[model samples]
Target: MLLSSFVRKGLLFFLLTCLSIHISKAQFLLNDSISYQPKKLTTLGISAGAVYGVSMFALNEAWYKENKREEFHFFNDAAEWKQVDKAGHFYTAFYLSALSAQSINQCGVKAKKSALLGSLAGFVLISSIEIFDGYSEAYGASVSDLIANAGGSVFYWWQQNHWQELRLQPKFSFHRTPFAPLRPAVLGENIPTEILKDYNGQTYWLSADMDKFMRFPKWLNLAVGYGAHSMLYARDATNTANGYDPYRQYYLSVDFDLTAIETDSKFVRGLIKALSVIKLPAPALEMSKKGVKFHPLYF
Candidate 1:
């Protein structure tokens, strides 16, 4: 089994907090002449090492202790959730790496160096999780997941290198679904838990800035999104027995770039930067196995 949703969120929050603090300190303490000082870099390295060690220990206790196996191996999960999980892996890796690179740049690191370090940090973090999975009996390392992870990191790096800005952003949105109550054990028991576990409610999106391609409003973008529904099991037999038909969802929508809004306040800029990962509420045209549907004010 994977780490509990709470634990995973906590881990990510902790890392982001640490990185933010470090960046703030670097801005306050370092002068242009002494930026990238050896002492600061050493401290950063030690702090990151400590954080990674603690995270690994906590994850092992929470997720791997009961599921570990004698032999390390791989498991094929390419078909699970109609590849929704794979898209998730790619999305997570891309955003984390991009954010890390931005944070590093804020700390007075050169853009190229920051990008390299950030990409490596993202790849290592997710790859470590895959290594843990390799030893688990219930779930093993997945090649497809690794590929997705790399793809995300590479995409982030390539975009930064070429454009110095992300014209195409990966985003996420979620809405509560009635289906979660039908299989609470496999999905989740509450909104918070279900948001993390239920693939049916979550949508992954690639929002492309129209201004990048042609004349258009700077804040507006065209988004293509993917989601899944009725996926209580990886295989169809169990779902059929339970009177559910699993299906994939595709969507087209409009999104906004909060960062594009003029903001002189540092805090507001930071908030906008963080919120950019989320797809804002808008009307969406959805296509699924059953047919077509429209969502007004979709999250």
Candidate 2:
């Protein structure tokens, strides 16, 4: 568990770093951000249909185990399985069909036919899953999941038709921290020329370690992080004699976009894009700080 936590934290940190860069860069591309065009409607429909059909068969075994009964197979309980014990089986097909429709739409499925085909695909796919789950002892099918699937299909279509806004910033930001790590290598030359002359009394710019990661700004897949690091007193120079450095040498920084989407950038677009075959959900961004100041778009 401890190791897992460390790994999880490390992954989060890495992702945060990447998002910071992605968003900063996306801010620059001043074009119609939302691209809508469907492709491969039928292919998605067929594939989803077949997969869900097979899945129903597996669910029968799960359902049998869940009921504390001997494992049941479609062949073993064909008569009993025919009974509509599960309510969501139909809806499962619905959602799958919806998903398949969405995929086809994304893959260049056209309108009218595309919408029809997408809807058919969703119904068929989702219903097929329901059938599979009907037989599972561990997992049962319900109308609720199917209803939810329909709602989801509608939701996707609503967004597709009325995509209010899109702000994908797959950009990179750089906040070089020269003042950090003042501890020079031990047994080395005392205060190298570059260091002594540079950081002695100069007020160095303490920006984020922007280069450490990039950002993922596709649609609303906005991931951002303002480097929260600190500036510590060098061991050689804690405090000069008696007069305290008064500036409170403790180092801490917090910078990030304050927006409506900050709460779930990773949950929505980031996860969806990752699960998909999207190679460039977040294209590269132009990262150099533009003239425009950062402000909350929703606010």
Candidate 3:
């Protein structure tokens, strides 16, 4: 339950920060005439620091402070959630790194430097939460989580340095699942929170920029996705004992690249970039232990 809360809060903070930063600093980001503005860099740094501080404080108050404190410790949760939570960590970190790099670039930083700094920033921001878990009696810091976080940041840096663009982008999608209603406390009670807590409903995707590699439409992407089903409990054994057999779900689908849309408005472009994290509904093929299925329109 707390793990879900952690994922939800961290994702929300990163997304909100990205939107606010881009909107508020439009002039800095949109202006190409200036290549290295010290003022802009400083302002961005201060703003990011402030946001980080406030977010950490809020997380502590909301999730950890109420629980009993314990000596800092490590936890082994690699077996939990069929590693879906780990995938969530990787997805979140990837976006956080991408957003940070984009934000820094807007402040006139060079792309290479921005990518490195942004990757570091992304790792730091996500891993900081582990400190909270380490001290909480209810949970311990997870090494697997830290590894996933690092993988996300490194993946962003690797793509930016090698391709100068994200040829393969990580994306996410979710839908209300019957499993959630079976475990409302662990999954969620409402639509919004359910999207965060319900691993059974969430799908993490790797959308390939087909045009970058071959003769394909720039607006179209071929994607592979990962998800889990019937995961009312973190462990497969517990879920099976409760009459739910947890299993992995894999998908092949097509995705739309909003950034490919030609728009003169900076706001529109930023909106597209921000919203691009979500995988739009399209035809998909699902393969799982239960059977193979097809969806004409899958979210």
Candidate 4:
């Protein structure tokens, strides 16, 4: 339950940040390296701070105002949603850190410095949301969530420092699931809500850039994915009581590395970069406790 709420809010937070970044990207050469400029750094810092302040304020007013406040507390939800929500935290954090690093890098900061600061920025931004949860009567902060968030930032930082490129990229995909109708209040009543709240429909993938290591097609990636279904409730026991047998799903699929596609137009390149976060529909082999199934075009 807490995971669903957090994921919804996190998605909104990420979208807001991406909007700010898209606007910034248009005004500056995102890839061009300029000489170290202190004024640009200061401006970037101010801009980021402003965005953070405004977004946090908005969240407090719009999302937290209605929830009853309570003393700070810790929640244990490690068993919820089959740990699919944890993967979401990792995915969101990685992209947030990556985006932050990219933004700072464009401001004339060195790669290592930018990455370090950006990773920290991502961690702080996401972790701060837990404060609201900690004080809410409806939701208490989860230690597992904090750990997932940290793991994501650290993973991004390590990759930036070592490979200097994403060899294994985290990507997401979703499809409408019948399970959402079973419990609309929990799973979601509509497509938009279902996309964020329905764990059954969501797949998190680790797409390995095959060409990065060996002789493979540059644009082709091999992806391993995780998902779950038949979950009308967050807990397996509760779900089973409701006559829904929830089970974890694993997938093997092929993905496209849009970054590998050569494009002369900056707009096209930027579009590709932005779209890279989505795992495109492809033939996939799904493995679960029930049995293995194949989808010709799985989303």
Q: Cα RMSDs of all predictions?
A: 3.5, 20.4, 2.7, 2.8
Q: What overall lDDT goes with each candidate model? A: 0.75, 0.32, 0.81, 0.80
Candidate 3 pairs with clashing backbones: none
Q: Summarize candidate 4's per-residue lDDT along 189-243 as a digit string, tens digits.
A: 8998888888999999999989989999988999999999888788999988878
lDDT of 3 by residue, 152-186 (tens): 99999998888777888898999999877877878
Q: Residue 73 lDDT in model 1?
A: 89
Best by lDDT: 3
Ranking by lDDT: 3, 4, 1, 2
Of the pair 2 and 4, which is ahead by lDDT? Answer: 4
- Model 2 TM: 0.30
- Best-to-worst order by TM-score is 3, 4, 1, 2
lDDT of 1 by residue, 245-265 (tens): 888899999999676677677
Q: Per-residue lDDT tens digits of candidate 2, residues 1-299?
A: 11221222233233223322222221111123325432343554455445444444444443333453334333221112111111122322333333344444455544334445655555444444444444545444545545545653454344334432212211122233443245333111233322222122222112222322355322233233121122223222343343323131111222232232334455554443332211122222222223223323210
Q: Give the TM-score of candidate 4.
A: 0.92
